[model samples]
Target: MTKHKCFLGLAILATLVATPAQAEEVSRKAADLMAQNSNSTDSVDQNSNNTQPPNTPLSPSLPSEPLYGGSDTASKLPASNYWYVSGSVGSASPGNDVQGSSIFNNKLNFALDSTSSWNIAGGYQRGNYRSELEISYSSFDVNNASIDTQSFPFSGNVSTTSILGNTYWDIPTGSKFRPYLGVGIGAGILSGKIKYQGQEADLGTGSSFAYQGKVGLEYELARKGNAFVEFKYLGIGKYQNDAGRDVTPPNSYGVNVGYRLGF
Candidate 1:
């Protein structure tokens, strides 16, 4: 009985020792499994972070193209077919003569008295010179200085008609203004009797040669025409009397405002 009891005790001791060893082995295996699972989770998280792409901003679209539309017609106009008329109201005065040999200096006095005159003219422009033809009419009051038998003072009226050919050399300054110098030669008819010292002097109807020189400025009012204001010195040569006496002719000068058209 004693031996059997001893054998049972030994069996119980072996059972306790084997149970502790198996439990220890089970705990080590579970700890290794947990460490491996944690390492696998860390690898998965690192791969996910490394493989992520950077964000990109969206770009705006380009603007649309501009449309173009129109016609072309600006260089087709005629420029040189124009005509003009001119009128002026001004005075006529004589010049100074120191030597006193100027017969028409102060010997004859003419009063325009702000009278108005008209001229019809046409022009053809070529390069920088304009050629013109003019027909004009003017009137003046003439006073003769020579006394009569009683030595009384007198004055008379005269009407002069002229037809002239003129040429002007133009100096163009810019787009709007041009200053010019011009000359003209013409034939004129002088009429009406003169009163010398209150007596009628028989100055017959006669034809006289006439000339004009001018300097003026013109402003372009149209595409091919200009409005002008000018100062002119006009000369009418001497006349012949009935007894072949060389009588004094009309020597006048005045300011003229006029227009010129191009052709």
Candidate 2:
């Protein structure tokens, strides 16, 4: 009985110690598994924060691309074929010193007033220089003249047409305001009639030599348009009338406002 009791006590102690050890081992394993799960979850969150979001708007990312959608890549103006056109309207005033001679060999002087004028031009440009073809028109009435007591104080309507070839030099200062100098030469067609003291004379349509010079400033109004103001001096040589007399037109000075279109 004593030996059996002793064996029982030893068995019970062994069972108690083994139970606690197994419990400790199981707790340790559980803790390790929890740490691994926590680390895995933290790593997943960190990777998600570092990742970029989807569907962000990056531009159609080249300079040549259209802003919206197109396969065509030309988004800027073409380099070649820099052609342009212009239209202008302004005032034309005559000079005081133009004179002509009648069939009687008498000196006939004229005084003219300011008149309305307009022009249209088209051209191509290269390297700051441009060549243009222009057409212009103006009309005026002469109020006073001096040929004699009977032929003085003339009354008349004069219409002029000009077809000109022009060249321009644009001073490139890389600014929105462009300053330029221009010169033009062509033929003028003059036609009108004059009356002095109940005597009327017809000035037939005749071609005259013409020339002009200009100074202008342009403002960039848009990508393809410009507004400008210009000062011009235009001269026309004498033309002969059907009566074998001369019709001398006065030199003209003009101030103009204009718009230009480029293509």
Candidate 2 lDDT tens digits, 135-220: 99998887887775444678887788999999988776655577999999999988877788898877677888999999999876
Model 2 clash pairs? none
Q: Identify the runs in model 1 with alpha carbons over 4 angstroms from their true place.
A: 1-89, 94-116, 148-151, 196-201
Candidate 2 lDDT trough over 10 residues, lowest sum: 68-77
TM-scores of the candidates in the order shown: 0.56, 0.66
Q: Report the error of model 1 at residue 54, Å.
A: 40
TM-score of 1: 0.56
Best model number under TM-score: 2
Error of 2 at 62 (Å): 13
By lDDT, the best candidate is 2
